[model samples]
Target: MSTGHTSVPEVLDALKDVTYPAGKEQLISAARQAGAGDEVVKALRGMPAEQYAGRAEVARSVRVDPDSDPGTDAGRRAGQARRGGKPGLSQHLREEPRTPIQEEFDR
Candidate 1:
């Protein structure tokens, strides 16, 4: 039942490129038990090679500085204008002076 090797360097070699955050050992164990070596190989089998350019560790981009003005009045107004950006054609028509033909058609 045993391969007769104490430490399978091949298994560790298979895990060379596999990386994860701390405190996710349960998932790693599950993958091994389920016959998948690690998350990298599991993901690579499911995804196209072109879609992934390999992995690297990087800091989070969403965490901005405390000194940055994220919700100032200018920021709020800009966000509001962006959210309500569609021009109102009906309101524009109401503001415009009517032509003689348009006046006749209205009556």
Candidate 2:
């Protein structure tokens, strides 16, 4: 599992033999037994002490190095630009006109 950095696939490979609904300790131990490196172990150690249902759950729960995740690369980020994000969360509220309309009854 030592490929310089820890990725989801690498983490999953290390935990392949682990039982489902395993806790943090169980994961760490299994990774170590599978010859995982410090980075992988560290990532697993940082995970919350909860039962994991399966590989998918563990993959989602584990935090991998940003550099290792291609989805967050500079190219992807540029492509996903939000045009400086939304105008604001409450932009619609400010769109209402302040001046009241003159109705026949009011007149």
Candidate 3:
């Protein structure tokens, strides 16, 4: 990782071989094994200690554009544009919608 901010593609590349729903330790280990530098590793360490289901999930956790590819410079620019310059993490953990039966019980 460079001294600058870590890119979403870079993080994803570091976790290419990581299993789904990976824990914090698993993610850090995978990133290290993939040759991630201190910046990238620090970013991973700062992420919420929870299981990530996929790259998209990790992207969201790190406040990157989940839809854009970070592999190329152009892609990184596109992702940044898609992000609209917003910084910090958004609400990733959401409550599941209740079924009709559950709603009725609440009522």
Candidate 4:
């Protein structure tokens, strides 16, 4: 996956004025009107043609570099900040089912 640093931010920044409940064509048009460069426009082009409920969905549709950060989530991607592993590997491998265990333990 490409580093998200250059993708989502640029796209979102270009789309800041866009309203929600937009379609593929609307997004592309808006992005272009907002003076988005080729990279942001190209990312928006890759999205599936459908009605988007909000910016979050649009962000989800756009591919971003998920593993570059070292936090507690998105660890299945490997090299992310995971909490556990065998040896000499990143700790946040996410080998365990995080949601179910956390849910069970929470109550």
Candidate 5:
């Protein structure tokens, strides 16, 4: 568990400019590079091993609401604003055509 409360925005801010579908190592590296404090780093390190498609997924995985603004309903609306109506990275991945090798492997 984290020693301090690390907000979702804090983590996202720390990971600014990070590429999507990032692995744990890359996320941690980005956080460290951004000079994230111990709590933020600890939260990221404790996340389950998986590919993260976007900040929202990472926020959810870390148990922080990407839309929450500390202590208000305003946070809910803020999340939509943050996304700017664009689809998440996972959505793009889902629509992407599988490579020939991948398609063959599935067969």
Candidate 6:
């Protein structure tokens, strides 16, 4: 759920006017030093209108498949090809290592 509000313009305005208690320069400096992504720093430097506009463009550029079929024979074949074996959580772990927190929690 959301706490404060849902207006895009208002959220952008808040992001533009957001102060880090430390300061804008400090925040920007920290963002730079911490190897923050280019998009993040760009959003910080620019105004709300620009940020929102760019975000809108990005959202528009995203290609969402509207014809997905999770139950078709082709879909099942695709799923099996992607999984390559086993299934579910076991398959995920085999492909990628888990974090320490996950290992501890699983135990």
Ten-residue stretch with the least lDDT total in model 2: 88-97
Tens digits of per-residue lDDT, candidate 2, 1-107, equal: 46566777989999999989898899999999999989889878867677788888787768676555443565544543433333321111112222355444476
**Candidate that would win on lDDT:** 2
Q: CA shift at 95, candidate 5, in angstroms? A: 27
Query: Model 3's lDDT to the true fold?
Result: 0.68
Tell me the TM-score of each prediction against the true structure: 0.19, 0.58, 0.56, 0.56, 0.56, 0.25
For candidate 3, write residues 1-107 as lDDT tens digits. 24366766788888999989898789999999999977778778767778777888787776333234334355454555554433334322222345799999999
Clashing pairs in 2: none
* Alpha carbon deviation, residue 68, candidate 2 (Å): 5.6
| Ranking 3 against 6 by lDDT, winner | 3
| Separate clash counts for every candidate | 0, 0, 0, 6, 0, 0
- Per residue, candidate 1 scores C-alpha lDDT tens digits across 1-107 of 33232122333343344444312243234336546544333322322212211122111111112124244455454554445432321111112345799999999
Clash pairs of candidate 3? none
Scored by CA lDDT, what does every candidate get? 0.32, 0.69, 0.68, 0.68, 0.68, 0.37
lDDT (tens digit, per residue) of candidate 5 on 1-107? 54456777798899998999898789999999999988788778767678888887887666443333343355434553454443332211123345799999999
Lowest lDDT block of 10, candidate 3 = 86-95
Q: For candidate 4, what is the total of clashing residue pairs? A: 6
Clashing pairs in 5: none
lDDT of 6 by residue, 1-107 (tens): 22222233322333343343333344345556666545444534432222223334322222122123233355545554575653221221223335799999999
